[model samples]
Target chain A: MKPAPFAYAKARSVEDAIALLAQHGEGAKLLAGGQSLIATLNMRLSAPRILIDLNGIAGLNSITLKGGEVEIGAMTRHAEIERSDVIRKHAPLIAMAMPHIAHPAIRNRGTIGGSIAFADPAAELPACLLALGGLVEIAGPKGKRTVKADDYFKGLYETAIGACDMLTGIRLPAAPAASRYGFAELSRRHGDYAVAGLAASATFASGKLTKVRLAFFGVDLTPVRAKAAEMALAGGDLDKAVAALASDLDPPDDIQENGAVKKHLAGVLLRRVVQQLTETRA
Target chain B: MNEMCDISLTVNGERVSERVEARKSLVDFLRDDLTLTGSHVGCEHGVCGACTVRVNGEIVRGCLMLAVQCDGASVETIEGVSDSGEIADLQEAFQKRNALQCGFCTPGMLLTAQDLLSNDQTPSRDHIREHISGNYCRCTGYHAIVDAVESVAQARKGSRK
Candidate 1:
């Protein structure tokens, strides 16, 4: 199906992109990898009048490590991020979840910033970023500002990013020593959007669980951080803590499953993550 | 509204410059404008890998990309996977193993497999399955499809001294 007609503007730099967006306002859309936007456009679900292409922008494709945090450029492709040794060593959860994102073809073109900006609740990267306490760097016509992962996501396919703002990069804190990562999702098939998914990171300090971050996707309007569950496991044993965490979660219903079923699956998966963490620590 | 956008792209190792609409998809530009129909458009959405093509050495869905988005990129379709007019090992294996029935999914499957084999010469059965998971086939149930890829991996390993 042919997409609705739109104006194409090639952005030479971050400032140019922001200016084009500001000029077009809500009628303008930034084209990064175009994995999500193009699809929505072809379906006529979104009809932006001007597409500000950011492919020509320099330095937006870099993946660098500095200040004890991994700063990934918004244009960095999923395949590149998946294959980065630095990302693997420092952010293994993102690496582990990369393959589960669509397939090799999509990963080759899909960008981390594009995924986050698209804000699909079912996508693995956003939930993984939330679990790692990441931050998004945005460039606007006025200036730049950073948004924390916890506060960035607003709702289904919605983010705090304004129409005149472009997500330039994302910063992920390095995982602490003794951190055990677990990512699990249930999809009808490989490359299919997950029906239900969970990503978890648990940090142990001196034989005690010091911090636990649990995030779930495909179960709510946004990739939700299970704060209640995190509180339940703050200073408890893995098994007992996961049990309490399970009781604290209330998953929503969707086309995949009913609310009761999702809640049950969330409990079962949380138990699996805790069990895996226990074994890794043991 | 009547102005045409000038797009310059290297397709299948050949440089081509064409005037296209701002909203024209890369798949349309390849199949209709540039006359490279190797990249098929199946679902017209990102879900189906039938429109898969390699842009700047990375496999991407052509249906989910604008022609202008690829202004300065290099694209490779199934036709470019082989230069000597001989079927590549993966393609030969697919035929030998009867991996294709209707053949509509062959081009996309071949392109996807090429991407996988380029990265992992010795992919496990599970790895191969994960590689082509995005390209769905309505026929054959994927048993022979996986076997075909495994056959190539085995042959490639055997030839590596």
Candidate 2:
């Protein structure tokens, strides 16, 4: 299990990586964590001529909390996010979603930016980011620009990140004190990709639900927010929101599940999560 | 055809530098170049944890990473950690618990179990199962392996107090 022959360069900075990408274009692939890239390379699925290794770039893995937002460097490992008290405090949604990522070993090497760039429909990170209305920072030839999570993920194995660009970091607005989060996924195995999953956050002022956001995975080309359900849940009537999911999500039919089955699981998860959110903290 | 990359790393507390093929995985580098054959390459796709090893104190899939990417990194394979007697009690517990039947999965299992012990000397049984979920052991049905790791964790916790 070796990759196809390719020249490797340890990128010193974002400028260096961007220059190499601009030089090689599609022939170059940025290697971060290498969890997905190397496996794809070894399987002969993709053969980029040059790999711009991003591991050498310093400060790409910093986790910063400022301006009531959590900005995580794109190269930060999943384990770091899982263990970061900053994430657990400021954005509990991300902290809640980390364990649902692959196992601890994979978490040790897999980067959140790589997962976001990969845009796996079944993965949990994208959906969590979507649920939290997070943003991604991309450094391209022009300069750095932030894209909302909603506009970031284009489709399966796709994102707004360009061939000559690199995802530098992720920005998550601080969750409010009144906000409560819930995440659940049903997979055949614990570490396996979920069959159907949902992540959600809802804010309550006094006893009235003011805002609710839900994102479902393994149901569409990208992690899709159930906008209809979110609107319906604003009134705190979970049954109405659960019913609205049927219209908000149009699930894909795969060998493991039909569209109807995924929709059903989505509703089941919505019910469980809504109950968890409304209940007292554990 | 090959493109060689120069990389330096500390493996088993020893500084090593070499020119390796850019495509060569860290597992192959450990096994073929340095002859540290303890880390096996199974399911080389990162699904199976047979190639699990410590890179800069974190367990990672050796097969999923290229040796060239590990420049100036510290890698500790089963050979180094085992030789240091760091996980001897866990190993003995595995032996007493019969965690392996065929022994092909033992190296990865031991390393994975040691990873859990190092992190939390008192991890829950479910935590043990969750941590090693990626390390597939098709032979033992996982009961014995969990038993071995859990026994070691409890024993170690008991001794610490």
Candidate 3:
């Protein structure tokens, strides 16, 4: 497999990248880690007129704690997030789910922004962001704007990022005191895309679960928040929570598995995650 | 906009300058232009680990990267590292254990194995398997491969002692 002939431009800054995007409009594709983009190019699934390489743009690869959130630059690689003590302390779900993203080699070059912007239904980062109540920062010709994680993801491979916009960074709220994190996924292989997965965050308060958020991926067009299941769990009805998944998620049949099978797996994951989170307290 | 660009990067240890198509993959550049065929081309879509290599000190899928994107970067392939004797111990261990049968996936397997050993000297069997899970070995079924890597890790620890 080989990519079609295309021109390449390396942007020196985010503004430069935006300018390049503005110039090319929909004809150009922004290259972050190139892990997924390059593959699409090689398969000729995508043939952009020009590739605007964002790797040369500085300041998009830093991980910092600002105010009450952990700010991760869009160009930040997955491996960096896996080892970052700040993430491990502040956004542990992202850290905990890092190894499942891919193998060591792929993680070395794949960027957090790429994963989020690509918006793969089976991806871990987007689901983690949703569970953590994170935010995505997008930059366009009119300047920068922030989109809530709840509003950022639209559909399969579709995001709030417009043709002339670029995702600059993502900010995850600092973990609350006594908050517990639970993350697990099932795949044919460890690094393959998940058959079904769950990322949940909840605060254990006085023998009761409060502010519980369960984000399930590989079970919908986008990472879905299981509010019904969360409500059931918060009300102390574990059986109801599991049963509520039928109303919460309606996964479509994919090449890997059937929709009914995916719904069943999602229920299984909810139980396991709840058990794991509660077990940590004892 | 030019479809071809000039790039000057270090391959192995020597600096090389050339003009390549922007669409050309780094693995193809190495195998065709530099004659460093140690890194084989399997599935070009980043699934198969047949084209694993090092760029700027970290391992990446060679096919997932474009040669033009590696401008000014330092790259290392199996041939380069093998010639430098960096993975000599791993090579010997693989030979002794018969970890490779077809040898098509050996280059990527060795690079991935060395990557794990260099990072953690005492990786568990499960951890080793997880780390190299991306590299598909169709023949060995991975039992012998894991054995070889584990033995080398123990030997390196012994040498240190």
Candidate 4:
């Protein structure tokens, strides 16, 4: 299928890309990896007047670790993130979820920023970022500003980013000492979008839960943080916490499964995560 | 008005320059413009892997990429995987094992399998399944496909010794 006619502009640098975006305004769409945007275009779902390709932009594909935090360029491909030694050591949850993405071929061309920008509720990275309390940096005509993951996602296929803004990079906080993380997703087949996915991180201090963050995808319009579940588990027996956390979440009904079924799966997965973290500490 | 963009790409290790509509997909450019018809377009959308090709050393869905986007990039279609008309070991294994009956999904399957084998020379059955999950086959039910990959892996392992 042929996409609607559009103008093509390749930016030589990040600044050049931003300038082109600013000049073209709402009709402009940044092309990063072109995994999602191109698909949307082919389906005639998105008919932008101009495409600002960022592939020529330098320095946006880097993965760097400094000051105990892992900073990943927004243009970094999912394949690169999955294979990064730094991500494996510092952000295992991201690594764990990377393989569950569409497929090796899609991951090879899909960029983290592009996925985050698309903000598909069923995608793993947004929920994983929320669980890790990641920060996103955006650049626009007014320069750059940072938004927390909790505030970045607005709804399904929605984000706080404006059309004129470009996401530069994401910053994941360093893994806490004695921390255990788990990522689990239920799908009909490998590479299928998750029916329901969970990313959990727990920090233990002196054999007690110091901090716990639970995020879920495909259960809501956006990647929900599962705040009620987190509060239920705080400072309690891991087993007891799991049961309470399960009851706290309100999973939605869909063709994949009924609300009740997903809720039950959430409970089962919450228990698994809690038990896995506890066993790791033990 | 439709805009034309000049795209210079090294496709299958040969330089090709063409002026294409900005919305022209790389799959169409390869099949229609350059006349390298090895890559098939199955799902037009990114769901099916029939249009899969290697762009700058990474496998991507050619149907989902604009030809203008491939400017200065290198692409490898199924045609470039072998020099002779003879198939690669994986392709040969697929033929011998009867992995493909209709052959509509063969090119994409072969490209996707090449991606997996290039990354992990000896992927397990589960790994092979996971890697090729994006490439769907209506015929052969995947058992033969899995067997074909296993045979290729075994042969590659033996040759490495």
TM-score of chain A of each: 0.93, 0.96, 0.98, 0.92
Q: Model 4, which residues run further than 4 Å from truth?
A: A205-207, A237-248, B84-87
Per-residue lDDT of A18 in model 1: 86
Model 4 lDDT, residue A151, Cα: 91
lDDT of 1 at A36: 84
- Interface quality of candidate 4 as DockQ: 0.67
**Per-prediction DockQ:** 0.69, 0.65, 0.92, 0.67
- TM per model? 0.94, 0.96, 0.99, 0.95
Tens-digit lDDT track for model 3 on A101-174?
Answer: 98899999999999999999999999999998899999999999999998988888999999999999999999
Tens digit of lDDT per residue, candidate 1, span A136-249? 999887799999998999978889898788999999987667887888888899878878788988786565555688888888888888777777667674456556645665
Return whichever of 2 and 4 wins on lDDT: 2
Greater lDDT among 3 and 4 belongs to 3
Runs of candidate 3 exceeding 4 Å displacement: none
CA lDDT of every candidate: 0.83, 0.88, 0.93, 0.84
At residue B64, candidate 1 shows an lDDT of 84
Q: How does candidate 2 score on lDDT?
A: 0.88
Order by DockQ, highest first:
3, 1, 4, 2
RMSD of model 2 against the true structure: 1.6
In angstroms, the error of model 4 at A26 is 1.8
lDDT of 4 by residue, A1-282 (tens): 678889888888778888888888889889987877888888899999989888778898888888988999989999999889999988888988999999888888899988887888888998888999999999987889999998998866878888788898999997867888878888888888888889988786566665789988887778887666676677565556556655566777876888777777777777777676666433
